[model samples]
Target: MADNQYITIMLQSLHKKEKVLNSIIQINKRQKEELENPSLDPDDFDKTVEEKSELIEQLELLDNGFEKLYEKVREELQTNKELYKDEILQMQGSIRALAEKSMEIQAQEARNKQLMEQKFASVKKQVREIRSSQKVVNQYYKNMMKKGYVEPHFLDNKK
Candidate 1:
């Protein structure tokens, strides 16, 4: 392939990678919003999680494809040093932008992960508190029974 053709292919791959990264970032933002909702439906959350997983898979595929294209571009440039310098420079700029976008997505994902961990911890604490309270209630009932107090049963009068 000609030098120009190699540059074009690299540029296209970079653009596709950027688009996928941007999409994944947007999905992360949406998931964060849903996480913040106290009444978020479980089904909706599941769907969002599934969509995010699919987007991540797509991003991985795009990254692999971009890497292959980048290697080809590098090989072409090294062999044909007489190619258009301006086009090669432009391709470099695009590659840099793609790298920046990927970093942004990664940062967003890290934040989301931290937020999820905090939420999980909070729930675990709540569960522990509930169990402790139940234990205290059970102990109280046992104490009453030791004092010869009989268990009381209540009948609902409402028909």
Candidate 2:
């Protein structure tokens, strides 16, 4: 195939990859919302994660294909500097967009990670409180068992 043809294919691959990245970014935003909500739905968050994984798989496939095509056209494009300038520029633009999306996703993921850690900490505190309460109850029962004297609520009728 011609170098231009290969370049066109690469461009298409880049577009597909960009779309996948956009989907992932949206998923990250949704994940952030889930983390921020006081009452998070585990099932919904799980579904979003699973969906993002599938999109990532698609992105990987596109990357592989783009790399293969780029290798095929590398020599020609390098040697013929001005021959395929337009397509090369388009590909560069697509790459720039992809980079921006990637950065955005990274920032979103960082926020989400922090939120998740906070949620975990809150749950850990609750568990500790419950355990402490249980221990106090157990101690009270132990103390009660050692006392055999029954305290009379009403005074004895010795009057």
Candidate 3:
């Protein structure tokens, strides 16, 4: 490809990457909403997790290509800075925008993770409560058995 073509491709890839990042942000927002609900369905949450995983995979693939294209563009800009001064400036602007978006996404994701951790802690507490209740019930049954408690034939009969 020609120098201009390479730069054009890199710019397009950057825009695409930006769009993917935005999608991730939206997905994380949805997840946060779901987590906020009191009756969160496990199945629904699993679906969101799957969707996020797929989006991340795509992002990884895009990054691989983007890196190569970025290196090429950088080399071209360095070698012919005078000739491609305008394009280089444009690329810089796009890069700055991408960095800002990435930072925003990172913040949102961190919030989501914290929410998830809180949820997990809550679930663990409930499980502990349930186990403790079960233990009490079992102990009561064992005591009754030890005392030879048996079924009474009549309501007034004590056995």
Candidate 4:
């Protein structure tokens, strides 16, 4: 599936782990509290024993439940590992595709750049030729004026 979906699933797994941890913590706390506040009424010793026995049975049940949860968590983690392997393979494929596309783009850009440089060089050569021709034309005009073949005009008629 998509990467975001995978992440969402992992987050849910982590939430489950958190809940299990909290339950375990709370159970341990209750057990500790009971141990510390044992019933002390001598006349109610039998009732207290019975109560303690029931508590012990409950604790055993809790322990069994925790064991089952632990096994389930382990199985889930293994499944996650397998799922992640597939995800990593998919990601690698995506990375490779992107890399290939990038390389193709870079090659196209390089070719375009080379073509531009060639065009620029051709234009520059044409400009240089034009400037050289202009210089030669200016020299020819100067020679004609010196030989009295042409006249120069002045723009002094502003009135």
Can you give the lDDT of residue 68 in candidate 2?
A: 94
Question: lDDT per prediction?
Answer: 0.79, 0.88, 0.86, 0.52
- lDDT preference between candidates 1 and 4, better one: 1
TM-score of each: 0.73, 0.83, 0.83, 0.40
Best by lDDT: 2
Model 4, residue pairs in steric clash: none
Number of colliding residue pairs in model 4: 0
**CA deviation > 4 Å runs, candidate 3:** 147-159
Ranking by lDDT: 2, 3, 1, 4
Clashing pairs in 3: none
Candidate 1 structure quality by residue, lDDT tens digits, 18-116? 787788788889988877776667798789889989877987886787677667677767876666577677777977887888788889889888877
lDDT of 2 by residue, 16-67 (tens): 8988998898899889888888898889889988998999899889999999
Summed over model 1, clashes come to 0
Error of 4 at 100 (Å): 0.9
- The residue-by-residue lDDT of candidate 4 on 133-152, one tens digit each, is 99999889978778635667
The sequence of per-residue lDDT tens digits that candidate 3 reaches over residues 17-101 is 8888888889989999999887999999999999989988988887888788777677777888999888778878888988998
Runs in model 2 with CA error above 4 Å?
143-159
Candidate 2, which ten residues in sequence have the lowest lDDT sum? 146-155
Cα deviation of 6 in candidate 2 (Å)? 2.0
- Model 3: per-residue Cα lDDT at residue 12: 83
The better candidate by lDDT, 3 or 4, is: 3
